[model samples]
Target: MGTDNRKNLRLEVFGILKEAVSILCKNINFLIFTIIVSFPLLSFMVYYETFLFKTMVETWDLLSPRDYSNYNRPLPYQLITENMNRDFAYKLIQLGLLYLVPLHLLELFTMLLTIDLASKIYSSEDRPLTFKEMIEKPIYKAKLSSTFITSVYVLFLSTCTLLGLIWLVINYSIMLRNFIYNVLFTVIYGAAFVALLMKYLEWSAQWNVSVVISILEKVKGVEALVLSAYLCRGSEKRGRLLMLVFFAWGVCLRLPCLVLGCYEGGFGMVLQNVFNSLGNVIKWIACMVYFYDCKTRILEKKVDEEVGNVESS
Candidate 1:
């Protein structure tokens, strides 16, 4: 049994990495598709960075040497308070939002395309979808709606969790003066923390397939959330394991940026963006694969249970 368990663990590790590579190899067109769609955003990023550099230089020059000596504070605070012009900052922000909004819209369009492409690749036995067909026929409404709802759910849960932690910390600190109260508070704090953590994990795991559900089942909003919860209830560990693999894959892909930063001089920023975008491509593929895997497992398990019930009867 132990040997079997160890073998399973080894296989699980091997499988995820192997599948990630396999997906990358099989999905070169998707990378091309993403890169093409992302060009505008990348252009904006480069332009904005250069503009920011020039602005920073101008701001620094505007602050005379005498101004620096007047304030005994951190450079960052001084930049905001002393050197920084509010009107300039406001203008920068306005200029920024103009590009940023469109960039994000392009990102959304790219994601829709990717999600459509993944559904075709994974969920069907059909031939690979061409980019044109993928875009033309792909469903968008459910994906958009479910994503918005999921975002709200995540934001709300995250906010509540943070507030709860802060409250616990503050109350626990105050109660620590009394020995009995401290002991009682510790137990309560530990319990609350564990409960909240578990809840967060469970909700997060359930939302893993919200996108897949949106694409496959045409479910949206709260209905999608409810369905995802129903599907993912018993697969919390697997969901978390997949998430870890996704995180690790992302970090490994971008590790070169850190290495390059250490050795390379000015051109490192350009290389970093290229590497990061490439990493994003890999990240998108791995994530879609993970989503498909989770959905498949749930569906197979569900079918098996139904079959077992039929056989027993």
Candidate 2:
């Protein structure tokens, strides 16, 4: 790759921030529409998740005393285990299949509206696909999503390989405090993996952003990825640093119950509320960054290295 313009990314950061503020000012109506329409889906998800019992144990009504008088004897552990597993597997299959119908529509329609908003709002100042433009350019968006998914899957596999090696060590023979070491390794490595995942996501955001432009205008993919990577040499650290900062912030959100426990009620009670809302709340921030990342990545300069090589030869 050509020498990366590290200094240039500072300007990019400022530009994105400015675009964010301006877009926020202009798009309140669209934002409201997004939230209002998405609310029903969100509400239904909550109902399905909480009421329907993700597991049969949570929702099932077993036969009463009169009906089960002959079944009073304690069941065999293996039989009980098999029954529990069967119930869990059944729920898992149903839950997975049930959402595909709604998820497909959201992915196909509602998601497109949001992407369109992103593309329109962020298209200025060399931004590639705005929230709006993505809807406008589905092929490019698909390519971008495909690239991201492939990268994450590869990372996951690599992590699994390393974890497999550790599993062998802990299970194969008598190793000193092997269980303790394994747990410690998981804690340390899991934190590091989360950090890396954040940085990797930011880096990939910089890749293939130009495809939004290309798909809309009919241009090059590799060129977009490379040029964006090159342009992002400096900004990587800033965004990567933000990821770590956010991770720490995330830690604070996670530990609120512990902090709350000291002031008032039992930890268990506090924890129940915290855990219930934590995932969805964190996802809210993620949804916003989804747009921000796409904006910066699309600004990459277009260049076809493959064509250049061919001509040179």
Candidate 3:
């Protein structure tokens, strides 16, 4: 019984993976358009971050004397004392938050295209979407699904961070308390994060579903989620294992870019670059895959249930 269940799960997840990948491979033009739309906005985000840091440094130098021998306090102390760099950093942070507004819209648009492809992949009949028609009228059943997806992740991360802070503050009095507390908190919270990641696997899958169903007008978001979860129910362990597989794949891809980023600067630059790359590339994919399979599997399950009901009822 267990073996049968496991086999079914593997088959369903395989369906989801093929659905997602085939869409990208099949609809090259739609994928290109998504990237093209995102490039300018993404480039601006990079430049805006770059300039903010540069400006902050320039402001610091201008305020301070070229030669600080005459000053009573040391440079680091003086910067803190005079309130030198804090405001610049704060402003840059605010700009980053605001910039996401445009990026969010761009992501939403791409998601619409991706979801359409997923729906078709699972369309028992394999109803593939064409480039010309898809561009003109994209699917949106998964539009709000994708939005809710973004919301859940942000909320999960925020909740975890708040919990960590509480643990730190409440236990600060004991000797070595913060250290021990942090270690324990990290483990527990890390597990929660993993579960959250697991739930997110549907993000990519969900959107793909939307795109697929746009033409057929088959399933909505709620049905899609439940169905996907069911299809992937037996494969949870294998699904998680696939995550580890992707994790290694992603690390290998970014390692070279990270090394180059390091030499592109110096020692401090090296560490910072590597850290940034890890955050953006590695973590980004993990979050993406979590949503990818979760949604696909749920939708696959939904498809079966719907089909069963139609034939039975």
Predicted structure with the largest lDDT when compared to the true one = 1
Candidate 3: C-alpha lDDT: 0.45
**Which scores higher on TM-score, 1 or 3?**
1
lDDT string for model 2 (1-313, tens) is 1112321342333444444444444555555555654555554454444323324333222211223344433222323343456666587567656554554344234433444454454444433333454334444566445433433333344445444543443232222224364565546545665555665546534432332333323334455456445645555655554434444554565355334432233454434434433333223223234334533444433335556777899
lDDT for position 190 in model 1: 65
Please give each candidate's TM-score.
0.56, 0.43, 0.45
Clashes of 3: 25
lDDT accuracy of residue 5 in candidate 3:
42
- Point out the worst 10-residue segment of candidate 2 by lDDT: 1-10
Candidate 3 residues 1-313, lDDT tens each? 3322422442343443443454445556655654554455445445443444455455545445445355432334344446556776676566555544554454444444444443343332434545665567644455555444543444344446544543432233221223453565545545665555554443333333332232234444445445444544555565555444454554564455444543233454434433443333223222233344544556677899999999999
Q: Which is the winner by lDDT between candidate 2 and candidate 3?
A: 3
Q: Report the error of model 2 at residue 20, Å.
A: 2.9
Clash count for each candidate, listed in order shown: 0, 13, 25
